[model samples]
Target: MNKVLISADHVITGPADRVITRGAVLVEGGSITAVGTAAELDTSVEPEVPRLACPGATLLPGLIDCHVHLAFDAGPDPLRAVAEADPGELATAMADRAEQMLAAGVTTVRDLGDRDALTVTLRDAIAAGTATGPRVLAATAPLTSHGGHCGFLGGEVTTDDEIRARIARNAEQGADLIKVMASGGALTPGGPRMWQPQFTRDQLRLIVDEAARYGLGVAAHAHGTDTIEHCVTAGVRTLEHCSWRTAEGIVYDPPTARRIVENDIAVCRCVSGDWRLFLEQMGPERAEAMAGVIRDMRKEGVRFIAGTDAGVPGARFGDYVGMLEFFSSLDFSHAEILDMATVHAAHALGLTDTGTIAPGMRADLIVVDGNPLESLDSLRAIRHVLTAGRPIGM
Candidate 1:
């Protein structure tokens, strides 16, 4: 059995909230065997085992992205590009995107959208050791209304029968979860308005029920206030882009926020890309309006998971650390933000063994040069990354 020992100045164990100084982790095969201070276990390991020591670094669980679109190329015209590419071509691009994400210490990612169910192919390849990338939990194709948000992906379902059939097809394809576009989006021109609800309450409930029958959780993409409320009532597991937009302006519905908390539904704000560019595109007034709504949601005790929405236009893969500024801007502590990217995100994705550093857990971790708890910027200083006890060649 191959064994490796890694010791760091500080080890964040269990969750981002816990830390052990001068800590060491022992890995045998692909699982963690022991985690404790170097002085406690260094002498007990086999003398022939290899050891890596970083005196001024911190080790923590590998990051998890709850929302992403691996099929989109993050190009200026991702939709056009996706529409033009065949499945084989799209899979190649997705593999490159996956490698980029792994380089940035994101060892696990939940792909919320894809075309042709290609993400499932990539997910299987990674699991079979034929690819070098994060462990993927992919939603084959997102359900959308006719000409609604992302309807071009070919998952448009109108009637209850269509919805059930689509859900069954995705489950047959080995989807890890189900994604439903419950509201209109800004990405599709001439589609429903961004503040418009795409699906009726009954349709949304049908999606939730059908997905539950397949033992798959539903992730609802909701921006409008009505859509958000519908998703909550439908009992979806997670809400993506819950911006609470309206025709007049952003609204902070306290009752809906409380309902989300009561249901324990995870929310992925999907904030990413260059902040400066985002501000310029959104304009100061619109940006501030959206930010205010998000701030209010945080105040209402909504649970947040960090997701970059990578592969979207301007939201490049491998830039996950840069997106941390958004949470910091909301006055989230470093530990809290890290939790959103790690433990909280893992739980949201239903990953049991990949998010925390503990005995018998998968050895997915990253070592940075400085203390991330003190400075979030340290996360960018990635000295090493291990996925399933194997080093990522950066």
Candidate 2:
């Protein structure tokens, strides 16, 4: 069971976009040991070794979604749904959502926010084999100001003491990273406006420093222009949304953006599968403007990793490839887009083991029916998925 040979019509061994026709990957002890042509690898393996042959399919490193919320259901009133659900019932549903994403070829997902710090329990369950799901990097409870966005999740902090205490508790609970609500959010009704900063500049800096002490990075949720600028100054590891919103409209700041590139800060737009409706929510003109700014910032060397913000009103657990398809409209190559979901995303999340199909990397990979290099739509044709060398059922 420790040795597996996965052969496919095409294998994408990446950090770069290299494709090998009739390729095979050898995985042993949950890590990739060899990758080459099917013929080359087949002859080298013993006849007793298990071989999973996938004809007319493309194999690539498993996809990663940089942001999602497992607490809410993708319904008109996910907040209400969360409030009403039984705690035990909610935990079961959240585990189901994580597995749903795994079936769609997403092998890893960063859970940014959830009620009751439930995501941390889910993460441990998956790792301990009591549950089946993607490798979840959970932010147990996102730090927020009193009456700020997503405060109901119990991460409210008005003083520096409160902030430090929250981080300490989350770290003790085995949180993979720290999430901070740097700005407001639309989903939280009684919270700050979507463009308002939730924490003072110094407070935000303190959060980042405190997280670093625990060997964790901070993912700041910022949508406002000023708030995005502040996150940059605070030296967060990643910026969620980075929407650059203002009362005037979505604004782009070149100076702050330049620093983002120079400092190697990653940006997660959290663009979900509901692209059309999401754009509609922003209005056509504003949507176009946001798209334009994303394009401009890409040119300016800003790195955007993939995230669906799943569990929102229209975002689904299995719709991660749809998010990648949206990026095609943004003028990125299929290879570049795939990298965003794989290598770029893993790096952004500080994950080193699962992003590439190479020696010493985890055997987290997927086989789709068609070549994704030709059309990203082929990504949806998931035929098989491997999470650390073990085949997972769809």
- Count the clashes in each prediction: 0, 0
Q: Between which residue pairs do clashes occur in model 2?
A: none
Q: Which ten residues in a row have the lowest lDDT in candidate 2?
A: 385-394
Q: Tens digits of per-residue lDDT for model 2 on 1-394? A: 5898889999999854788999999989778999999999999988888899999899999999999999989898887898899999999999999889999999999999887679989988888878988999999889998988888788999999999999999999888999999999988889999899999899999999999999999999999999999999999999998989987888889999999999899999888788977888778888889898899889999998999999988998899988988889888999989989999999999998988889899989999998999988899899999888768973
**Over the stretch 206-310, how does candidate 1's per-residue lDDT look in tens digits?**
899999999999999999998899999999999999999899878879999999989899999997758668878888898988888778888888889989988
Q: How far is candidate 2 from the true structure (C-alpha RMSD, Å)?
A: 1.2
Question: What are the Cα lDDT values of the candidates?
Answer: 0.89, 0.91
Regions of model 2 farther than 4 Å from truth: none
Pairs of residues at least 3 apart in sequence or in different chains that clash in candidate 1: none
RMSD (CA, Å), each prediction = 1.2, 1.2
Q: Where does model 1 exceed 4 Å of error? A: none
Q: How far does residue 329 in candidate 2 sit from its true spot (Å)?
A: 1.2
lDDT of 2: 0.91
